[model samples]
Target chain A: MNAADVLDGGVLDAARALRERRVSVADLVAESLGRINAISGLNAYVDVFGDQALSLAQAHQTMLDCGYDLGPLHGIPVSLKDNVDMAGVVTTAGSAILKDNVPVADASVVSALKRAGAIVVGKNNMHEFAWGGTTANPHYGTAGNAWDASRSPAGSSGGSASAVAARTVFASIGTDTGGSVRNPAALNGVSGIRPTIGRVSNGGVFPLAWTLDTVGPIAKSSQDCAVVLQAVAGHDPRDLQTSAEPVPDYLAELERPLAGIRIGWIHDYSVKDVQPAVRTAFEAATATFESLGAIVTAVAIPDLDAIVDALVVLDAAEPSALHGRWLRERGDEYGPDVRAQLEAGFVLSAVDYVQAQRYRTHIRARFAEAFRAVDAILTPTLPFTAPRIGQDVIDIGGRDRDVHTANMQFTALASVPGLPALNVPMGFDAGGLPTGLQIITPAFEEGRALRLGHRFQMATTFHLKAPPR
Target chain B: MDETDSIRCRLRAHGIRETEAAVGLAASWLRNAARVRAVVEEVVGPAAGPVTAFTHVPAGLHGEERRERR
Candidate 1:
């Protein structure tokens, strides 16, 4: 297959091709690296080490020739968000403060992916400290939506999401603090999952909020995410917060039918002013889910707004707390916007901090109750189409709404509740920007959400659609 | 009405000095509670003092220190 055809194949197909000796790891790695260079205009990567990737791919090929199976991702080239530590590499988190910060070891996730035989092609850019919703970084230039260069790729995982969407990398990992992973995934037209906080270790990844920080995959398909997740998910004693709960075979669960699953749709979370096209596309997705033997229910999640608010507050507070000193002494070192938000975090009170934690505990129960009645919750990943770069707002239902808040509306909720939400491309909006239908399930129930999302994608043409390369 | 400002003052009044250049220590700790707390009140409605997780840093820094010790 040609580069375009190879790039379009999902991770499993590509891996199966490599496993069966139909494709060379060197070829795939070279193609991905070439695309990354060609799409340098997208600013999707923080750094790309083409030589290193080729070396790793060759090493894996050598092992396979010796009848050695490294793992599921033997020859796959995977990009990581810059915030993740990769031993010899600097982890900037797209910030100037840690621009020179290098690690002596790889993050658990990076280590796991490497152990599973995935090639680390490069590090993707992100909003400073994973703070903002829009990936317009003052430090690293904003990563444009692959399909529409003029539009914003949602942040702080924007670069990772954009890279995958742009076919610059087979798949990339992004941290979802508020809506970092899903918003970018939605806007850039890809699949990403913010697995339950403790379900995935946060050992070496930069922290946005210890309470809400979870590392997840931004991939071309839920199946791809499962492949990536298998390598990354598991308890690391290093992360005391990681659950001892058994990690299921996520890929095996992906093939299960979605029949009789109860899915809840939140029209309110859909936002009051979603573009008519987005709403119609989202509804069509819901109808598709309904047709697949899944019962769609509209359920009100109590304290939904408060939960999102609490999550934002908590997310802001923790990062600010973790990075507060660096910000104070070297405030100029940060990107202007990240510094501003971190400064805002410093202004919150101790009571407010406690309240956010208490709110997290209080709000999680409400979602738990809702999940008892439904297998998953569904909403649009983003309420509107992607906005133009430098366009900080959009006209929503006649009102020009702030992009950050609007982009985060549906996504922040899942963070607060600590649930697993999958962002699957639904269709383009009026602007031809990709829109995603977010599927959320009870904490650690990524299986249910993935099964439902996989089925939905199987019945729809959206996942098969691609950005103009 | 200025919740952000109230948080600011609270962080200041309580003397939450940052350990590094990146964070403000105290105020940064409270953001999520404020946002989620507001919604909790909206959804659950009218929480008494018991439902609130806040323990006022007593009039003195001593009280705040003691509270932290807990």
Candidate 2:
């Protein structure tokens, strides 16, 4: 297999190859560093730890010589979103305020990945503080979309998605609150999961929303995500929010057959809001699921628009609480847009905050009732292909639409419900850019979503589509 | 909506201090939302059940520690 194929291959496949000693760790890290250097214009990383990643790979090689080995990710290089803390590295959430902020220890997920024998290659850029969906960072630099440099890699986890899609690394970890991970993954034609809340401990990652924030992986396929999930999802005493449940064999779940799986078609949920390109790809995805022997039905649980407001209010409130003092003292350090949103969060009344929580409880119950009749839900991942840079709005049809609004058209619902959602690349647009079809499962049913995604990925060629350098 | 006044009220009431511009935008959203809510009430009528909330925990289940019993 070519270096791209090996790097982009399933983590299990790579592990088997590593176990057999067919591919050396030194060589793999070299190829990844080459890919990052080749695409220097994407600016996917805030700092590329070339020496550190190489040193780790060498250490893994020595481990093999000594007849000792780490688990599945032995010798694989992984990039981390900047918001995640790593000892000796600055955790600049793509802003000047924290640009000089260096961490003395690793984030919980970073420690987990290291224990699995993965190499931390570098820190990825983001839309400052993981607040906005687009990955455009005026401070560090926007991580350009893999297919088109003119368009964005979706953020605030854009850097992680682009680095993986462009073959800069084997896999990367990113945060998802209101679709930070999945948005860029879809935009870049890769795979990412927003695992159920509290499944992965958030201990070391900077807080976006103490209640809603989650850190997840962006990888080449659902299988890759499953491996990363195994490494990262666990309870931590530092993060009391983590569930005390045991981690399952996510890789085994991927091989589960799609037969008899009931996937609900949320076609009309926001059909009017989605772009025609996304709408078409979603229909194709539903057909693919049916052809695989999965029964499908139309269902509507609750208005997503109603749930979105509750999620937004709650998300903004938490982040604003953490950053309010920073913003007040160093207002100029923040980007104008982030400042505006943070400011708005402060004005929300205590009653309004309480009411949003109530609304969330009500919606969760409503969705639980719907899930009783269906195993999964399928929807468009993003409403359209990437819009050009410098244009914060798109003229969809005759009316002007905000780019942020259009980007989250499909993603916001899952975020609000705190359910598991996967963004799997479905197909390319006419311009060769990719569009993703989202597969969503009810809270804690990530295995089912991965199974469905893995099945479709095996049956289709979209997951293999690569952007030319 | 002076920053100092807004900050004082939010801090005292909710332990938060906010900028004036943020409050203005929030107020705009609140105003529009209240209008929409009132209209919905006119059509669907007032809620028949109490607005159940989980604000104050029961004495036995009070804090994150949740007073575990042997």
Please report, in order, the local distance difference test score of every candidate based on alpha carbons: 0.77, 0.77
Chain B TM-scores per candidate, in order, are 0.32, 0.43
lDDT of 1 by residue, A1-469 (tens): 6545676788777867887777788888999998999888888987998999998878889998787887668888889999999999899988888889998989999989888888999999888888887777778788888888878898889899989988877789899877888889998889999997677889899888877789999998888888888889978998887877677788778777877877887646654568777889888988898888889888886556665566667766677788766865786787766766676676665677766666666666666566666777888888887888888788877788877667767887687667688999999875678998888876666766777778788898787777887
- The CAPRI classification for model 2 reads as incorrect
DockQ of each: 0.14, 0.12
Share of native C-alpha contacts between chains A and B (below 8 angstroms) recovered by candidate 1: 0.27
Per-residue lDDT of candidate 2, residues B9-48 (tens digit): 7543543344455556566545434433443343332342
lDDT minimum window of 10 residues, candidate 1 chain A: A302-311
How large is the i-RMS for each model, in angstroms? 13.1, 9.2
DockQ of 2: 0.12
DockQ of candidate 1, scored on C-alphas against the true complex (2 decimals) = 0.14
